[model samples]
Target: MLSALRKYLILPKLIRLSWSAPKNRTVAWDRYWAGIARTGARSDVLWDSGTDHELLAYRDVLRRHFDPSLPIVDVGCGHGAFSRALTAYSPRVLGVDVSPHAVARASGESAGVEGVSYLARDMTGPGAGAGLVGSTDANVFVRGVLHVLDAANQAALMENLRQLVGARGTVFLAETNFQGNPVEYVSHLGASLRSIPAPLELAIRKLPMPGHFGPEELARAMPKDRWTLVEDGAATIETNPLMDAAGNSRVPGYFAVLKAKDPDAGR
Candidate 1:
């Protein structure tokens, strides 16, 4: 208990005393997600935090195009909130995250949603060389996750994802381009507590983690042969673009889904 407080509160403040803007936030996850329980004013933050409006719309668009029933697998699905949402339309969904605590919490509270399940796994997919033996009847998504890794890891993870999807599967993705929406720009705005660095933004654009492409770069990474970029999907936060003054002004991201070149490979 003392350790948790010290680490989250005291230690972070101490670090802040000498803090340079956090250049590498892959490590940032350690502290960021720790305090995300059911207490904040945005009680729904845990349940529905995506990159932005466009991305959320991407999810919805995919929901309309893809079959929610084929057992959708959401990789790095923090609290399974999206999985639960998927269940509303499709009866079977599964969420996976690297954090076991996240999985346990999601699975325990979400027990009533008969078809949805959250489980713990390395989640790195194939590049780690660990064969996660299994296949899904539907699509596999990596929303809000690619941004956290280094590019090589991202490549390995996506390659693994491709393997899981086989020749005929779909993949959904959402990530931040720190280039345009650096941390300092939007950190203190709405619900997030931590701040980021401008350098992290420029660097990711120059060298994104594994499949880490900008909105347009997404086309190069997946390639049409393995996966064709489907139109962006709909997200929970689909809102008016004109509402920019109402949004976090700085960082902008979108939700997107991809269909496999051969639709039948995953099924």
Candidate 2:
């Protein structure tokens, strides 16, 4: 009964924060990560998908843009899943997340993994990537991050990505492009009062409600004058919960490959 009441109280807060003005969401994400870590069930997170196949499906698409010699930064890399997979190609991989607890958890899980490291840094602030500026020529990989940020925060993140990639490196981002009302969307993903997927519940009850990111959003976030979009297309974002008879749970997604335009090259 107490648990039910607690959940009842959380949903309203979630709705409020979802529409609130964009600010530093480091606290919210930190809280969410801490909570998730306490659950001790890592594979059940909504975005985990519990398989490397998710990244495998995009490996070919990414191979066309990533420079194998360059270090890869997996931004918003919760638990370092993709960071580990990236080691198959890149000699060095850095998994960065806004939550320190998340970084610790990922580091703990990836203890013996060679060529992989983790950092906790918030990319949604001005001058966020100053420490990483020297990581020039480093490629970036972001999945399911942009849709959780508003335009202002998105632009800030893009600036940080620009700084990290420098001149020659590229960035690959994949974001959910869900197009439905929040209630309908959650319901379709298998949420209910009786039983909600832990990760989805955590997102709805704590983190910012997700938004959409498609071609237009990409154009706005990384304008052609400053960034070049090398490639883009439709994709599917797999989830860990709510499998159907086909044994899969997925959502509409979009992926883009981009490179920062050099200021000196044009002259």
Q: How do all models score by TM-score?
A: 0.64, 0.85
Superposition-based RMSD of candidate 2 using all C-alpha atoms, in angstroms: 5.5
Estimate the overall C-alpha local distance difference test score of candidate 2.
0.77
- Top candidate on lDDT is 2
Compose the digit string of candidate 2's lDDT tens values, residues 116-199.
998888877676666653545689999999998899889889987887787878899999998876665665576555565666
Q: Candidate 1, after superposition: displacement of residue 216 in Å?
A: 4.3
Q: Which stretches of candidate 1 lie over 4 Å from their true place?
A: 1-35, 39-60, 125-136, 178-184, 187-213, 233-251, 261-267
Clash count per candidate: 22, 0
**Residue 31's C-alpha lDDT in candidate 2?**
73
Q: 53-156 in candidate 1: lDDT tens per residue?
A: 44345645666666654556778877676667666555667787776666776786687778888776755644531233354445676666775675655655
lDDT of each: 0.51, 0.77
